[model samples]
Target: MNRNDRAIVALVTLGHAMVHTYELSIPIFVSVWLASPAFSADAATLGVVATVGYGLFGLGALPGGVLADTVGSKRLIVGCLLGMAGSFALLSVASSVWVVAVALCLWGIAASVYHPSGLSLISRGVEARGSAFAYHGMAGNVGIALGPLAATLLLLVLDWRGVALVLTLPAVLGAVLALRFDVDERAAVADGGTETDGGEEAGDSKADAVSSWPEFVAGSKRLFAGGFVVIFAIVVCSGLYYRGVLTFLPEILGDFPSLQPVEFGGRSLEPGRYVYAGMLMVGVVGQYVGGRLTDRVQPSRVLPFAFGLLGLLALAFVPLSSVGLLPVLALCGVLGVALFVVQPLYQAAVAEHTPAGTRGLSYGYTYLGVFGVGALGGTLAGGLLTYADVGVLFVVLAGIGLAGALASFVLGRRA
Candidate 1:
C-alpha cells in the first residue's frame, strides 16, 4: 500500500473497530447488569432496552449518509468519533436503566454515522478499494471479537462504569488521529481521480458544500432507477441473517457442555465468551480472503456461494454441536468465515451497482439495510428465545441466509 492507502486504511479500520467495540460491549453491559443482585430486568425487558439503542444505530444511517455526501465524509467521521466518545463517557456515569438507555441511544446516533462515512471514504479515497474494505472489515471483526472479551475481562477488574469510561479513550484518540491524519474525503477522491466501477465521477470536488434536498431526492430516484434496490434487498437479508445468528451466538455457545469456566492464574475464565471471541477472530482471515477475491473475481459471483454456504453452516451448527465440542468449534470457525466473507463482496457490490457520485448515499442505504434493519435481529432473537428454542432461531437464520443467497444469485446474473 502507498502512503495514502495506508492512511485511509488506518483511519477506517480504527473507526470500524471503535464502532463494533461500542456495539458488542452493550451486551456485556446487559449481561453484567442482569447478573447484579441490585438490579432486576427480565430477558425480554432488557432486550427492549437494548433494541432502542441498536434501532437508533441503524436509524441514523440515512442522515449520516446525507452528511457524508453533502458535508464531507471526514467531517462526519470525526464528529461521529467525538460523539461516540462523549456518549460512552456519559454512559459510564449512568445509574439508572433509563440513563443507560439514553446513553446507548446517543451512542447509537454517534455510531450510526460511521458506516456511511467510512465506506464512502473507502469508495472515494482509496485506490485499492477491495484491499481497503478487507482491512476495514477485518478491523471491525477484531473489534467485534475484542469488544466482548475486553468487557468481560475488564469487568473482572473494574466496574462496568470503568469499562465504559476506558472505552471512551480510544474513540477520543481516534477522532484526534482522524483529524490530524485522515485526508479530506473529497480531496482524496479528486487525487485518486477515477470513476467507480459503476462509472460516475467520484464526487464534485469543486463544490465542498452539502447537497440540496432536491438534488438528494433526485439522486435517490435515479439510484433506484439504476436498480440499486436489488442490492438493498440483498443487504437486508444479509443483515437479518447476520443479526439473528450473532445476537445470541455467545449464549448458544454457553450451552456447549465442554465450554465451561476454566481457571486461569486464579482468575475464572468463562470459555464461552473466549470461544465466541475466538470464533469471530477467524473472520480476519475471511475478510482478507474475501477482500482479495473481490479484487480478482466478480463480487456478485462470490456473493451467492458465500451466502449459500452461510445458510448451510447455520443449519449444520445445531446438529454439529449435538455431536461434540470439536465438531461445534469447527462449525463455529467455518461460520465465522462465512459471516464476514460477504461483507467486502456486497460492499463491492454496492459500489459496483451505484454511481460514484452518490457512493456515500448508496452506502448509507446499504448500511441502513445492514445495521438499521439488522438491529431487529436482536429483538427477533430475543423473541424467539422467549417463545421458541435455539433450533427455531437457527432455522430462521438459515432461511434468511438462503433468501440472501438466492438474491445474490439473481444479482450476479443482473450485474
Candidate 2:
C-alpha cells in the first residue's frame, strides 16, 4: 500500500475497532445486568431493553449516512469518537436500568455514525480497498474479542461503574488521534464523477457542502432497484444472525456444566466469560480470510458458503455443548469464525452494488439493516431463552443462518 492508503486504513482501523469494542462489550454488561441487584429485570426484559440502544445504534444510520455525504466523513468520525467516550462516561454514573438504557442510547447515537463514516472513507479514499478492509476488519475483531476480555478482567478488580470509566480512555485518545491525522479523504474519488448531486458540484469540503435530500432519496431508490435489494436482505439476515447468536452467548455457555465456574485460589472463576471472549478472538481469522477473499473472489460467491457454514454451526451449537468442555470451546471457535466470515463479504457486496458517490448512504442502509432491524435478534434470543430451551434458540438461529444463505445464493445467481 501507498502512504495515502496506509493513512486512510489507519484512521478507519482505529475508528472501526473502537466502535465494535463498545458494541460487543455491551453483552458482557448484559450478562452482568441480569445478575446485578440494581436491575430488577429478567433476560427477556433486558434483551428488549438493550435493543433500545442497539436499535438506535442501527436506526440512525440513515441520517448519519446523509450527514457523511453532506458534511464529510472526517468530521463525523471525530465527533463519533468523542461522543462514544461521553456515552460510556454517562454509563459509569448510571444509577438505574433506565439510566443504563439512556446511556446506551447515547452510545448508540454516537456509534451509529461510525460505520457509514469509516466505511465510506475507505471506499472513497483507499487505493488498496480489499487489503484495507482486511486490516480494518481484523482490528474490529480484535475489539470484539478483547472488549469482553477487558471487561471480564476489569470486573475482577473494579466495579462495573469503574470499568465503564476505563472504557472512556481509548475513545478519548482515539478522538485526539483522529484530529491529528493528515489524510487525503477523497484520494480515490478525486478523479471526479463522484461528487455530483443533481448536476451540482457536491464536494467533500464545506465550501461546496454536499447536501441534497431529494438526491439522497433518488439515490436510495436507485440502490434498492438494483442488486442492493437482495444485498439489503442478505445484510439484514446477517444482522439477525449476529445479534441473535452473540447477544446471549456468554450467558448460554454458562448453562453448560462443563464450562462452570472453577475454584481458583479460593475464588470462583467463570470460564464461560473467557470462552466467550476467545470465541470472538478467533473471529479475527475469519475477518482476515474473508477480507483477503474479497480481493481474489466475488463476495457474493462466498456469502452463500459462509452463511451455510453459519447455519450448520448454529444447528450444532447446542448439541455439542453437552459433549464436553473442549468440544464446546471448539464449537464456539468454529462458530465465531463462520459467523464473522460473512461480514466483509457483505460489506464488499455493498460497494460492488452501489456507486462511489452514494457509498456512505449505501453503507448507512447496510448497517441499518444489520444493526437496526437486526437489533431484534437480541429480543428474539432473550424471549426464546426465557420461554424455551437452548435447543429452540439454536433452531431459530439456524433458520436465520439458512435464510441468509438463501438470500445470498439468489444474489450470487444474479451476479
Candidate 3:
C-alpha cells in the first residue's frame, strides 16, 4: 500500500469502526429494554421493532448509493458520522420503545450511506484494494468487538442511558478525522482500464451517473442482467445468514447454562456479553485472512468454501453450546472467524465483477441486499426464539447458512 492508500484506509477504517461500534451496541441495549417495565415486549416483538429500524438501515441504501455517486464518498461519510452521533444521543433519552425505534430509524438512515460511500472510495481509489478491504474490515471488527464490551462495562458503573450517551463520542471523533484525511477516489481507476466486465468503458457506465430515475433503473437492470445477478443473490444469502445469526446472538448465548453471569468489581455481569464481544474480536483475524486471500486466490473459488464453513458452524453452534463453557466459548471464537471471513470475499467479488464508474451504486445495492433484506434475519431470530426452542432456531439458521453456501457454490462455479 502506498501513502495514498494508507491515508484512505485510515479514513475508512476510522469510519467503519465507529459505525459497527454503534451498530453492535444496539443489541446490548435491547436486553435492557426487555427487562424494563416501561415497555413490556417479548423477544419477537422487540425483534420486529429492531428490524424496522435495521430494515431502514438497509432500505435507505439505494438512494444513499446514488447520493454517494453524485455528491462523493467523503461528504456522505461526514454526514453519516454526525447523524449516527445524534441518533445515539436520542437513544440515551428514550423513555419508550417508540423513541428507541425512532433513534434506530435515524441511525439506519445515517449509517446506510457508509458502505456504499466508503467502499466506493476504496474500490476506485486504493491501489492495494484487497489489502484495503482487509484493513477496513479489521477496523470495523475492532468497533464490533469493543462496542458490546464497552457498553457492558459501562452498565456496571452507569445506567444503559449513560452507555448510550457515551457511545456517541467516538463518531464525533470520527467526523473530525474524516475532515483531516483526503485521497483520490479515482486513483485506481486511472491505472486500471476503463472497461467493465460487460465491455462498457468506465465513462459509458457513468454517462447516466446523474441522469434521470429511469436511468438508475436501467443501470440496475444492466448490472443484474450480467453475472452480478448471482452476486446479488449471494449477498442476499450472506446478509440473511449474517444478520439472522448476529441479531439475537447475545440472547442466544445466554441460553447456555455454562455461560452464566459473573461477578467482577463487585458487580454482577453477564458473561454472555463478554463471550459475544470476544467472538466479534476474533473477526479481526478473519478479516485480515479473508482480505489477504482475495489478493492471492480467486474470491469466487473461496466463497463457497467460506459459506460452507459458516453453515457447518451454525449447525454445530447449538449442540456445542450445551456441552460446556470451554467448548461453547471456543465455538463462539471459531464462529466469529467463519462469520466475518465471508465479508471481504464477497466485497472483493463485487469489485471484481462490477464496473469502476458505478462502484457507489453497486455497493449501495450490495448493502441493500445485506442490511435491507438481511434485516429480516433479526425478525426471523426473534420469532423463532419467541415461539420455539434454541434447537429450532439453530435448524433455521443452519438452513440459511447452507442456502448461502449453495448460492455461493453456484456463483463460484460460474466464476
Candidate 4:
C-alpha cells in the first residue's frame, strides 16, 4: 500500500483504540463506584454487571464482522465510536442497577464493533499485514494501559458520573475524525486483486470476493483441524489465565494494607494501583518486542517461553508479599509483559492461516475464543476469590499458563 493508505490505517486504528479504551474503563471503575453510598449494588452484583458487558462484547463480534464486510469497516467504526460515547453519557445519568446494566450492555455492543472492523481495515489496507497488525495491536495495548490510569486520576476529583462525562469527549472526537477520514474499501481490494487467465465473469468475480455467513462458518470449521486447533486452545488458556488475574488485581491488592496506600510526594496514593498500571504500561514494550521477535523466530518458540516465564513469575507473587514494593512491581511488570506479548503473534497466526476472503470472519472467530469463551476467567476468578486466598488464584492462573505453553509446544511440533 501507499504511504497515504498506511497513515490512514494508523490514524483510524488509534481512534478505534481510544474509543475501546473508554468502554473498557467502565468495568475497571465499576467496582470502585459500586462501593460508594450513591450506588446500592453489592460487589458480586457489580461483578455480574461487568461480566454481562464482556459476554455481550463476545456475542456481538460475528454480527460486527458481517456489518463491516457488507457495509464498510470505516462506517461501522465511526458508528461504534459515537454509539459508545452515547452509552457512556447514559451510564453517567443512570440511577438504578437496571439502568447501569442496560448502559453497560450498550457499551458492550459498541466495543464489539471495533476489532472486526479495525483489523479488517488493517488487513485490507496494508501490504505487510503482520507489521500493520502489530502496530494496531500496540495501539490497543496503549489504550488498555492508559484507560485505568486515566479513570483513577479523574476519580480523584470528580464523582463517578463526572468521570464518565469527562471520558465521553474522546470517543465523540474520535467519531468526528473517523467520519471526516475517507477509507475506500473497494479500492483497497482492487489494488490487491489478481486477474484469472480464464477471464471470469464480473458476477462470478464479485461473488468470489464477498464472503457470507455460511462461508465464514466453513472457514471456522477448517481452523479447528491441524495446528490451528492447538493455537486456538493455547489462546483460550492464555485469555483465561490473563484476564482472571488482571481483572481482580485491585481487589486482591486491597487485602494487603502495606501495599494499599502510603503518603508519597505529599499526597496519598494507592501504591498497588500505580504498580498495576506500571505493569500494564510495560506491556507495550513487551508486545512490540514480542512482535519484532516473532517476525524473526517462530511463534511457537516465543509463545511457550513467554508462558513459561509467566508461570514462574506468577508463583513469585505468592512469596513476594514481604519483599519491598519495588521488587513486587518489577515481578508484576515482567509477568504483565510476558502475558500480553503473545497477542499479536496469535492474531498474525490466525491471519496467516485463513484465506483473504474469509479474514474478517476468521478474526471474529478468533475473538470468540479470546473474548467470548475466554471471558469466563473473570467469573471463575471472582468465585475462587469469594472462598480461597489470592495465592490460590495465582496458582490457578499459573496452571492455565502452563497448559497454554504445552499447547503451543505441541502446535509448534505439528507445524
Predicted model with the maximum lDDT: 2
A best-first ranking of the candidates according to their TM-score comes to 3, 2, 1, 4
Q: What TM-score would you give candidate 4 relative to the actual structure? A: 0.89
Regions more than 4 Å wrong, model 4: 40-42, 184-213, 263-268
Give model 1 RMSD, 1 decimal: 2.4
- Cα lDDT of candidate 1 equals 0.80
lDDT of 1 by residue, 1-415 (tens): 6677788788888889989987887877876676676556655566677777887888898788878877777777788889999999999998888888899899999999899889988887777778889899999999988888888888788988999999999889888888877463543455344553333554453342237888778878877885588888888888888777776666667777777667888786667777777887888888888989988988888888998898898788778887888888888899888898988888988887766667777888888888788878878887887788888988888998899988888888887
Question: For model 1, what is the alpha-carbon lDDT of residue 363?
Answer: 84
Give the runs in model 1 whose Cα sits over 4 Å from its true position. Answer: 182-184, 187-210, 262-268
User: Whose TM-score is greatest here?
Assistant: 3
Give the TM-scores of the predictions, in the order they appear: 0.93, 0.95, 0.96, 0.89
lDDT of 3: 0.85
Model 2: ten consecutive residues of lowest lDDT? 196-205
Q: Over the stretch 84-201, how does candidate 3's per-residue lDDT look in tens digits?
A: 9999999999998889999999999999999999998888778788889999999999999999999988998899989999888889988998999878766766534563222335
Where is model 3 more than 4 Å wrong at Cα? 191-210
RMSD of each: 2.4, 3.2, 2.0, 3.9
Q: Model 4, 92-201: lDDT tens per residue?
A: 89877888889888987887877777776665555555566666767777787687778877867787788888888888888787777755553334423432211112
Model 4 clash pairs are none
